[model samples]
Target chain A: MEKSDEALMLQLQTGDLLSFDTLVKRWEKPLLNYCYRMVNDVALAEDLRQEVFLRIYRSTKTYRPTAQFSTWMYRIATNLCLDILAKQRRRKETPIDAYLESESDGFDERLIDPSGAPDAVVLKKEIKDRVRSALARLPENQRVVVTLRHYNDMKFHEIAEILECPISTVKSRMAAGLERLSKMLSEQE
Target chain B: MDCRFFREQIVSESYDQLDADAKKSLKAHLQTCRECEQFQVSLNETQQTLDQWEEVDSPIDIEALHDVIQPKPLSLPPQLPAWRWLAWGVAACLILTLSLSVLAWIGVDVKWADRGLTLRIGQESVPEITEQELVRLLQAERHATQVEIVKQLQGALDEFSKQLQVHLEERQKQADAQLVLIYQGLQSQRVQDLGFIRQELQHLAGATEAEFLETQRAFEFILASHVSEIQKNMK
Candidate 1:
């Protein structure tokens, strides 16, 4: 039987490095996706994911299984992302529209269909670009709630735990987010 | 019933989180309410639209990440502390003195005394030398040894100075990087704090405006009531 994450964590507390490796492997992709959605930059997401893992490794000695391992991991990731976003906001380095334009260009080049279906691929890319743009335009709080709920498929309570907010707040944010998303998506149409 | 409440219920319903009773109530309301029904449809459509944004596989290099996270052994040997090096130098001097003494004790005519070294190679060491000649010879040898020792010390000092300069430069670069990071962090924190304060001020302003309007309405009602009472007395 596979060891539970908590069991692996316990082993890690005992200095079993193999357990750490296992935890990393299990979590890296999901974390990568979460970070990618949060930052809206692939390179930045990768860097953040690596940072999250490094933090987890460094904090192994003090790690407690008081909560689910995933919750603690996500808390670390969410903080790192929020910190980066805050720094970016202060710098005002890349405006959202400019970032979207650059990203759309890359998407156009990278998402070409290998099956020789250019029209279908273009339509799909357009839809995806619209969705990504709308998601990016949301306020950070609403965006996080939406992303955690919709993309990560986390329960409202679980999201509440991760965000350190009340479940009602999470739901309200989700509702507000979806309402705005509905308007934005329709506007695009 | 306010449709606004039902809209929140719709959102919960869309996520399949509505309990049976709430779901039944929402269903009954949606049967008669076009706006709430349309909201539910729009939310569904939005979710469907988001589904088009597929998950891409992560391109992280696990091996590289593993290498980065793992504790690495020191590539270079650990540097010795200055005191250890000093102790080793003292031990080397003592060893050299002991060897010289052994040679002298074995009748090799090598004598090391009062920081001066003397050596005679063969057993035929019965040469008659004057005390002044001996003193002159010892002084010349001592002066040569002092010059050589001074040269070696100067070389070691030069090397040590260079290493210290390099180390200080590296430390300066690291400190500069840390300062930059600290400045950026502080600036970010300041921005966040200002934003929070601005939001609080706006909320306070909104509340104060509402309270002022309510007080004005109360005063107007009281004034109208007084005027009616005076009109009745005049009649």
Candidate 2:
């Protein structure tokens, strides 16, 4: 049975180590998907996924049940990934050591994104990657608002709270980011 | 609503967050306007296409994470009192400024060269000195005294920063008990009596040495004045 995010978090705060392990299992895939899309590096995304959980551990004392647990957890992850990206801007973005379709991914094309013999899905992912690459090139705030909204399916109010922006502002940024992405996608097409 | 108004509304509408009136108006507009309806379709398709971006899950090596965490009890630094942490941080920075000054006095050129490094210094060298020649002779006797006095000050400041880092680690270690005490004090303080918001600003200031020192003094001065004011108010 699926537990409510709040309940899982309550269990987590009480030092139920198994709750944390379960939370990690529950969230690891979605969080990785979100992070991997944002960062475009498998290992860094994995590393960041761990950092997100570790941060959850560190911030357990401060965690409140006022918001959904996924919101709280992803907010921390998004912010950390954004910070990593901002720092990385001074040098490089790709983990140069891990980009050659990592050998750890054995020779199964389905493994890359699990496209079940659908070329459209594969192409769509390529387009997604291109759009993401373009997004990383945009200003940080724009990238985050778009990621939180379009990718995470967060409502404008939730995104505003996460970003601490007015709803109008989040809308403006998402619109602007999507506009830019439309241009980039058109160019790629 | 004008087309522009409805157009702007469409983006949020696409998010499924629009109110009933606005949603009704937009739906009506889409029914009447071919352009908007086609635009809505394209937007919908784009979102569906974005589904491909979701990451395929990866297998985790729990043993690796357990390896990192199992070594000891959690190694997180104990949180400190704002005033004490600020004080030690400033004191540490001042001490750093003095140490970097010393390393400067030890010399920047030869010491750097001996460490198998290179620096682009005196870009437009004097008439007698080519940068290449100076770099080559940096280790020689002629430039042995090349350690400039001003540079010595910088080395001392860097040394201070290094030492301060050590002190901060020790301070964090030593504060374990004191933090427990202060945590108790805060816990005991009536919530209405005091309110605090902790700010962790990693981007304290500019990266340059001179800028860093100025930033340190400014923060220290700000906190010191604020603390004194708080004490006065309490009295």
For residue B175, what is the lDDT in candidate 1? 100
* Model 2 chain B: ten consecutive residues of lowest lDDT: B196-205
Clashing pairs in 1: none
Q: What's the C-alpha lDDT at position B108 in model 2?
A: 41
lDDT of each: 0.87, 0.72
The residue-by-residue lDDT of candidate 2 on A1-189, one tens digit each, is 887767777887787767767778888888886777667676788899988888887777678899878778878988988887777776775553344335224422445545355786566556655555565555778777877888778888888888777988888787677666666656767
**Location of the lowest summed lDDT over 10 successive residues in candidate 1 chain A:** A104-113
Model 1 alpha-carbon drift over 4 Å, by segment: A105-113, B76-235
Put down candidate 1 lDDT per residue, A115-163, tens digits, no spaces.
8588888898889889889988988899888888888877788889999
* Highest DockQ model number: 1
TM-score for chain A of every candidate model?
A: 0.92, 0.81
Give me the candidate number with maximum lDDT: 1
